[model samples]
Target: MSEKATRNFIDAYEETRAALPGVGGWLARRRESALDSFRETGLPHRRLEDWKYTDLRQTLEKAAFAPAPAHEGAVVLPDRRSASAFAAIDRHVLIFVNGRYRVDLSQAARLPKGVELHALADVVHEQWAKDLVERRFDDTRQAENIVDLNTALMSDGACLRIRKGVKLDKPLHLLFFSADPGASHTRNLILLENEAEATILETHVGEVASFADVVTDVAIGDGARLNHVKLQDEASDAVHLATLRARLSADAKLSSFTLTLGCGVSRSQSFVLFSGEGAEANIDGAYALRNKQHADQFCVMDHAVPACTSHTLFKGVLDGESEGVFQGKVIVRPHAQKSDGRQMTHALLLSRDAAMNAKPELEIYADDVQCAHGSTVGELSKEAIFYLRSRGIPEAEARRLLVLAFLDEALDLTPHDLARDALKLLVSEWFGEAVL
Candidate 1:
């Protein structure tokens, strides 16, 4: 089954290779190389240790999705709050429909000096973009091999470069909507030079039974900072796979948060590597799932240098027959002394049929490192609910309050104030609908 699905993808690549961006260039060669690797590995399945909880090969074999066609028309955004959570934020908006950039709908004119923003095809020839695309996080090869599929078939994405000591005046929003029911692959490249700063907001919302594969590569230079927030709320029958690979230089800081509210089966993978001393990476997220939704969050934090700090926290609530998985690891290499790393995941089950699987591990090679990892899965406190109900609060309201407080810890970690508030509101609204 896996081999057949793999052949289907390979055939699609062969048919679309001519129309894909960066033909007859370095990118073209890179695409062919990635395709070869993908063909060798095929699709990940339950037999793989890293993918034991999610059988992507079986799912794709059953779905048999074709390539999403280029959509040409005005996009009708979903009616969910998450679809427009960042509408009020002052930012440059770039819209992509069916894996194709829509220049007519985008608004990113007059970007600040030293800031270069372009579509994937426009920047694929640049050295910085090539470096980011070619970079590899070998430590997590088992979990990252899926990225090869995106590298070979990626159609369009955002390319952002921030020069040294420069800061983006406002956030940059990348809005992707799946207008057709097929498949779309997107690869985003972000480069921040020394002392540079930027905030990026990403929203994925649609109501089609589609396959959305996305990869984002980020490079943060010395003394630089990046604030990233993403919201994923797609159709209940959609398959969403996203991978993020980030490298941090000396004294750099990265704060990333993700909010997952929808999708039938979704897996989000993040790999962070500290290449220099004194770097920090804070990855946190909150999710709410109901019905038959299944979501997975996989993360790895590697401390290859000394005196770095890394922390990860994820909180979620599951109801009905939904399932959630959190697999995370923090690694401190030899000679990487004084590394402070922590990882934690907590889930609240609102229904008896709901399930949660968590595996948090810490591997320390240095004697002086301080690292710990933990996970907790439990149902809502009936005693607390009764206590609130005795005080005249409605039962539904009491349950909502408890779930909100449980998830607030992770949501508070969102670096942007406005984005944090918007996420909080969305979570609350989601709970209200679920209880109804």
Candidate 2:
């Protein structure tokens, strides 16, 4: 049955291969190989240990999405505040409507001297792009295999490179809006050269019943720093799948945070490898779901080198009949002496019907390393809510305040100050709407 659903994607690829980027080049061959891999593995199902919570194969089979049609004309962005969370911030914006880059709607002019930014098609021939795309992480094969589907069908995305010792003056914002009702695959490649620094802001929002598949590959060179913040708030009927793979070199730093608010079914995966010592990686997120929305968060932190540090924390609130899942693991290799890794996940269930599943694990082989993991799932404190109500606060408002406070710990970890405030505001608005 899963193979039958996989045929749809294979057929789409065969039909669109000629029109995709890097025709008759290495990327074309890469795409063909990726398609073959996808053909063999099919979509990730619940049978897979890593995908036990979210059955992507079953979900995609039910949706039966075809290729998203090419979207032209002006795109009216979603009217909700979550759709434009970063509008007030000063940054370079790139907009993609229906999975195609809209140069007319993007504002990436006058980038820094050493910064290189182009559409996925424009840089497919570059060695750096190829290296980022072809690089593999061995620890999370099952979780990362789904990336082959994105590689085979990826239509367009942002390709960014920051040269050594360069610092981007402002953030680079990638906005993906699904204006049509179908499936769209996107791939983003980002490379930060040694000692370079940059920040990335990503937002995905749409109302169409669509399938949005996205893959991002990042390489942070020695002493480089990359900060990433992402927000996902698609339609209630939309299905979203996103994967991020990153490698940190010696003394490099990566801080990534995500806030999930919408989508009927969504799965987000992150794989980080510490290839060099003294590097640091911080992955954290907060999510709020209502209705029948279901979200799954999976992460793998590979401390392959010595003297590195990694941390992971995820906190979320579930209401209505919504469900949330978190699976995270931290690995410290035998030679990774002095490595420090920690992971924690906590959730608040606002309704009896709401459900949460969390699994946090640590694999440490280094005798000199410190590693810990924990998870907690519970409902809001009745005493606290009653105390607020007795103070003349409306029950709805009281619940909102407590939820905000509960999520603040994770939201506070957002690397960027403005983006942090923006996420907090969006989460607050989402809770208000959920209650109403």
The TM-scores, one per candidate, come to 0.99, 0.99
The global Cα lDDT (0 to 1) of model 2 is 0.93
The whole-model C-alpha lDDT of candidate 1 against the native structure comes to 0.93
Error of model 1, residue 125, in angstroms: 1.2
- Candidate 2 per-residue lDDT over residues 106-132, each given as its tens digit: 999999899999999999889999998
Per residue, candidate 1 scores C-alpha lDDT tens digits across 1-436 of: 3788899899999989999999999999999999999999999988877788988898888898899999997788888788799999999999999878999999999999999999999998899999998888868788555888999999999999999999999999999999999999999999999999999999999999999999999999999999999999999999999999999999999999999999999999999999989999998998899999999999999999999999999999999999999999999999899999999999999998999999999888999988988999998788999999999999989999999999999999999999999999988888888872
Off by over 4 Å in 1: none
Go through the candidates in order and give the C-alpha RMSD of each one to the true structure: 0.9, 1.0
lDDT, residue 287, model 2: 94
